[model samples]
Target: MLLARIIKSIVIIIFSCILLKIIQYLLKKLFEFTKFDTRYEKTLCSVLSSISYYIIFVVSLILILREFNIVDVTTFGTLVTGASIVGLIAGVASQSILKDIFNGFFILFEKQIQVGDFIVINEEFRGSVEEIGIRSTSLRDWDLKRITISNGNITSIRNFSKNKMRVVSHVRVSYEEDPMKVIESLEEVCSIMNDKFDEYLLKNSEGKSISEFKVYGVTDIEKNPVGAQYTITGVVESYRYFSASKEVKLQILIVFKKNDIKIAYPTHINVLHYDNDYKNEL
Candidate 1:
């Protein structure tokens, strides 16, 4: 009888594994048929898979208990009822886990964040979201370090990948230079950069690229360095923001050098005088 029960338990475990795989496969096919957003589909499938695993585990454990005469359908409920203290302790211990699961579900259903999104959590831990699980979310930071954060602990999130990001570059020029000339030169550089990085830049509703990049001109005057600060701005896809900003700065330097537009810098002068009486004495 013991050997037979052991074999039945093994068979139950194997069957549960097979059932899980089948469910996963069906889920994949269902998502594919619905044509949902790829990220949303992935999140939903993961959460559902987790839930399925938990259900299967509980069902398999109950079956094994019954096979060994340790517990039956009626006795299981009695045991639970008799262990009120133990149940209360377990419930208290699982409060955080329950909170995490609830918050995770809310995050998924509301579409607040998604896998592959670059976000900053709590104004820190900025990274690309790698996974959104039932209890935690994983992120890959700029340094390539993987960070796992509980969903319940995530208070604020700033998602940068959802829309176009603005790229702003500041250029400083000597106060002596004409603001209009500086603007013209910067505008020319903007045009050149727009053409050079056309593929990375975002377009307007009119299907034109002109509004994508522009020179804002003389945004501020720096007294310490005695220079006029010009602002150049452009809109691009979020992923291309860093590269686009770097390229804009490089192009500004090149254009400014070519146009003899001296960048702002602190200047120091020294003067010495000799008196005629001192000269005669010498």
Candidate 2:
């Protein structure tokens, strides 16, 4: 009888594994059938897949226990009572953890943020989303530091990965340089960039990347002691923001040099004075 029971438990475990595979397959089909936008769809699929797998595993564990004759009415009742008492103690001791879990579900279902998104939390920490868990969210910053914050503490979110990001380039030139000439040279540079890195420039309504360049001429003119600063702003898809910024700056440097535009640098003037009285004293 013991050998027969052991064989039954093994079969139960095998069946549970097969059921889990079926669940995964169905979930994949469901996600594909109800396709949303790219980023949202990916995030939704990830969270739901994880949650489903966890549920199936828990249910399977109970079935396997039953197959081993380990679960009975008396035992289950005692376990439930013990769990209830423990839960009550835990609830009172860690109210904030419960709040974190609640808020975490809200964040996931409402699609507030997603994995791989570049975000600023409370305008304090800027990082890319690594994982969103029931209790906390993990972020990986540019410096590669992993920051974990409880979901309940997240008051504000600035999601940069959702829409097009503005690329602001500030080019400084000597006050002696003609502002018009500088602006004109920048326009030419933009023209060249539109052709050079066309694929990374912009996206049309159909989500196809296209060449689009805009020169917001001289957004700022700061009269520093050294020189004046000119700010140029343009928009590009968020995915390409970093690469596009670097390319734009390189093009700006090359264009400035080609146009003989003088980039701002500190200059010191030394003066020598000669006087008859000073000569006599010497």
Question: In model 1, where do residues sit more than 4 Å from their true spots?
Answer: 1-22, 60-71, 76-86, 173-178, 204-206, 222-228, 262-282
Candidate 1 displacement at residue 148 in angstroms = 1.1
TM-score against truth, every candidate: 0.74, 0.68
Name the best candidate (by lDDT): 1
- Per-residue lDDT, model 2, residue 31, is 73
| Predicted structure with the largest TM-score when compared to the true one | 1
Q: What's the lDDT of the predicted structure labeled candidate 1? A: 0.84
In TM-score terms, candidate 2 sits at 0.68
Q: Which stretches of candidate 2 lie over 4 Å from their true place?
A: 1-38, 49-84, 143-145, 206-211, 266-282
